[model samples]
Target: MDKAIIDFFQNFTTSNHFILNNIFIFFTKIGNLGMIWILISLLFLIFKSTRKIGIVSLLSLFFSFIISNLFLKHLIARPRPFTTYDLKILIPLPKDFSFPSGHASASFASAFGIFLSSNKKSLKWVVITLASLIAFSRIYLSVHYFIDVISGVGIGIFCGYLSIKIYEKIMKNK
Candidate 1:
């Protein structure tokens, strides 16, 4: 099923279509190590109104990293789809276990964390859209399986919710 899904995406991509490949590669690059999400969190930190959300988003990203990247990746020890199969990925191959995509987890963690803490619908949608793109790029790039991206999204949302609750509790006690 995983291979089938990947092969399906392959139909949309061709070696001649460097433009499309570059676009997906750009999305995947921003998601690398959650750098873009961290930058967003830091930008939020610069404002007093968003400081709490910023902190919470950072915590959410941290939780996602620890759970998906550190623990589950090692525990499952699943190889990247590119390693397991002969898929032609758009970006440089990643050297790590691939069950539960770290990119998807971190992107959704920060996006959903901000969504939970902020009241603006537009901001929420924007972040969610970006996160979704990042998650899909992982599969589009053939770095992760469909199940891995889906599970990563679930873990990310859970971590984001957990961070929000933790922040609320801390603020209430203070």
Candidate 2:
């Protein structure tokens, strides 16, 4: 079942080359670029109430990525999909571990953080869709295995939820 899903996305990587290429480039760059996330954090900081939430979310995502990619990756040292398979890699080969995608983690961490902070149900759905799309894009680009993406989503969601709960507790205490 998992192989089928990975194979399906691998096929899309070739069939939807144009779209996947653009998406892969976007995600690859944005996921690694700290400047973009810093800028986003700054934007959120402009609004007093959102500032703290933004900081917490950003910190949570950073910590999650560090633990997953830096510590855990080195410890587990799982190989990337392209390394183990015959599929054509749409993006440049990632030098780091591939068990849990950092892109999916950061994307979902931000999306879910925003969803938790906002009162609008519609916006939550929109953010959820974006998170899902980012996760799908990772698989479609052949950069991440099915398990990697799923684990990333789980980790991201947990970090996002934990950050929100911590923020709420801190705010209430103050």
Candidate 3:
């Protein structure tokens, strides 16, 4: 199933539409190192009204990085789909393991953190939409397996919710 999904995406890579490929590549680039999400969190942090959500989002990103990138990736040691299969990669090859996509995890962690912490429905939807696109871009780019991204999404959401609970606990203690 994973190979089939990847092969299906390969069709897009071979398509004549450079614009569509560029859009997916753009999503992946923004997600790299979680730079865009980090910037968003910092913007949230700058605002007095959104400070708490910003803090939660940062914590979520941190925890997701630790769990997905540092720990689980090493533990699982799953190779990238491109490594296992002869797939065309649109981006530079990642050196790390591929069980959980760091991009997907970080994207969701930040987005879900905002969703849980903020009251603005529009903000939540916007962030979640971006997160979804980022996660999907991983699979579309063939850098990650479908299951790897799915796992990353689950882990990222869990990390996000966990960060919120931890924040609440700390506040209560204070």
lDDT of 3 by residue, 12-125 (tens): 997765887899999999999999989999999998999999999999999999999999999999999888888888889989999899999999999999999999999999
| Candidates sorted on lDDT, descending | 3, 1, 2
Error of 3 at 85 (Å): 1.3
- The C-alpha local distance difference test score for the whole of candidate 1 amounts to 0.91
List per-candidate RMSD values in Å: 1.0, 2.3, 0.8
Residue 3 in model 3: lDDT: 92
Error of 3 at 57 (Å): 0.2
In candidate 3, stretches whose alpha carbon ends up further than 4 angstroms from where it belongs are none
Query: After aligning candidate 3 to the native by TM-score, how far in Å is the CA of 160 from where it should be?
Result: 0.7
Q: For each candidate, give its TM-score against the true structure.
A: 0.96, 0.84, 0.98
Give the TM-score (vs. native) of candidate 2: 0.84
C-alpha lDDT of all candidate models, in order:
0.91, 0.73, 0.93
lDDT by residue for model 2 (1-174), tens? 666877887676677668657876675566553344456656777898768756766866776677676776688778887787788776667888888877777767767776787677896787677667777777877778888888888777887787788888988999
Comparing 1 and 2 on lDDT, the stronger one: 1
Best by lDDT: 3
By TM-score, who's the top model here?
3
Clashes of each: 0, 0, 0
